[model samples]
Target: MAEQTTEQTCPQCGLDMPVDAGYPVWCTGCEWNVAPELFVYGLGGTAARRRELAGRHSEGTFEELAREGTRGRRARLTASYVLSYALALMVHGLSFALLGAGVGLLVAGGGNPVAWAVGVPLVLLFLVLLPRFPRLGSRVPRLERADAPRLFGLIDEVAGEVGTRGVDVIVVDGRVNAGVHTYGLRQRVLHLGLGLWAVLTPQQKVALLGHELGHFAGGDTRHGSVVGSALYTLRLWVEVLRPERWNGRVARVLVALPLTPPHHAAQSVLSLLEKVSLRGFPRREYLADDLAAEVASTEGARDLMETLLHAARIDDELHRLAADLSGPHETLWAQLADRVAAVPPRERERLRRVSALEWHQQDATHPPTHLRVELLDRRGPSTPKVVLDRRTEKAVERELRPSARRLARTIAQER
Candidate 1:
């Protein structure tokens, strides 16, 4: 049963967006909306009380706000990295120490010959079982300015607007998302998912890139090195204790009994540290969105936000199409764009309502589309001067068409 809750209002536009136990509320005036889950922050309060608690902060330099908000998460991440490295060192130290002890016992013929016998196998086991960090994969392909000057020029302009060094590499892999990655100290790579680009207008893509480039200006990618490596290290140790990877089922169970403790312990600590270290991600997303709004047009922001609301449904269609290999072949990429371009107004409205139900936290990086839309809407409409005529958009598509075809073919061949 649902409990009584206070009426809520848009903290940005100051319009009633009542808090119900189930339904999301949207402000009519500003058209700002949020999912019901956000109501938890305002539960059991009068309209006045809810308004007081859900107070809106000033929107200004996103970079400053992101750094200020994520300071705690950043500290915890640094600590987590230290823990990860210490654990790695501990594994190495234990392995070497066991090897030395076994050798010493054998060389001297210590008091317990039986103990030496046990040590010999134990040292060998540790040596064999010591986990190694997997080598980084070079699966994703990179894009350079020489390959696509127009796309790179647009990215560089966005980066310049956000006041940062342009990304060193642009990696385009066919997917429906985009982000920046840091590699080897100072090199940064920008990943632009062509699937998403295929579905968005050139103007809206400008907004998307602005959001990603904003991460650079906000210094979020810089923090990824330690936090990301810690997660990888945690995975490596957890993989080390996999009993299933052992020789015989009987021996596996016998060996796993003792190994289980460290396995669970590592898993538990890693789980908590991950959430704590990334708790500030939603705020960082907002900062990125703000940069997008500032750099791109308000209309562009609206397009990007609305597209996010429709993304799941569109992606599902893409999946189905990719599965039906017998379907038309020549214009498959164009079909994805056609799907987006063909959405009816009434259907779009229905999708917004349906997608609004999914506003709960899945991760720290992104908030639900409704909240992001509301946030963007509150920024007030600004005339974005990005004019990507059909000719230019068609040209961009032509450049990307080959990659899209390859992705579709790959997906079709997957069993």
Candidate 2:
């Protein structure tokens, strides 16, 4: 039986509010305890400051987008955007210069021992750094058109509705997330994680597809080649420049003396790119959510957001099952499905309240879940552009079964 909700008086407002039992008590009138002072553990110094800046930037973006609406005119030529792109071009240019110099050294110093010694290392360095550029594609299990026609057809229908081209490839994995990314000269790949997909309703799955495809339609610059490649390069530079830990204090200081300045410089540029990209990402995410609402109906999109609230719980259960040596390997997904379905309403509401208090979002780039859900509520109901029927949904599930079993067994054995 479902638990009954009871009325409780708010201390500040003295208003009787209906709240589910065994959940956080907060006032609807005064909004008490909604954002209680959190006892955060490991936030201080540089990390704390970055967190503060990210939160402030994301919140500002949410408010601005919410006020102006997702369809509001977007200014593409902001100072931050220009500066970020300029830095990206500069980074790429420097990399090319290094590459050219390395090759030139090898060509000019043909057989000289000293020259070969110097040239070989430079050439090797270039080769070492080359893989980070234009990074594309993962090694996950790929699903071909013939393998799942219904699924691909559904994706095509969504792409049509969203005004984008269909994906070139679809890959399934064990992660509890899904995304769309470009690889190999703009070939789009859609990644579907069975951990999340298997439990979603058919319409929720449509919403997921709409949201991912919407990233393409929205022209997400952060994920685009220029900024994306630059971000990766800067990250690699940071890792390369980081000072090594030494046993002796003098040795550590010596290593730091040479590497610290360049390391800090690279980090500053990385932070700048991240800050600029953060400005664009929240708006793009909200726009994607808007597209998701359009394609899957407001109710479907809203429900999907609500489902995200329980993601941590789902992840925790997956980890617990993974760590259990005696757990049945064959029934991994089935056990997860049952556990998810058994999450009580009170716990769901508790998760919602926790999200509000923590200002939880999918990531730093995403707006808070509460804000996104509210934006959807403000947009009101939308008629779905596409719907997933039960038969087609079942067909897709059956098509995914082989990979699902393989992934499940892998997870089970990894313990």
lDDT of 1 at 126: 60
Per-candidate TM-score against the hidden true structure: 0.64, 0.76
CA-lDDT, candidates in order: 0.62, 0.75
Residue by residue across 72-151, what tens digits does model 1's lDDT show? 22122344345544544554565567687777766777668787777787678567644333232477566666776666
TM-score quality measure for candidate 2:
0.76
Name the 10 consecutive residues with the lowest summed lDDT in model 2.
Answer: 35-44
Best by lDDT: 2
lDDT digits (tens) for residues 1-415 of candidate 2: 2355677887767887666554455665665554343543223354355446545665787777768776433334567668778888877777666677877887888877887777776676666555354434465569888998889999999989887877878888888889887665567788898888876888889999998898888777565677777888889988877776334688677776677887898899889888876677766787788888889998988888988887877777776776773654546777777777766565566566656556678877787888788888877888999999999988987888888878888877776
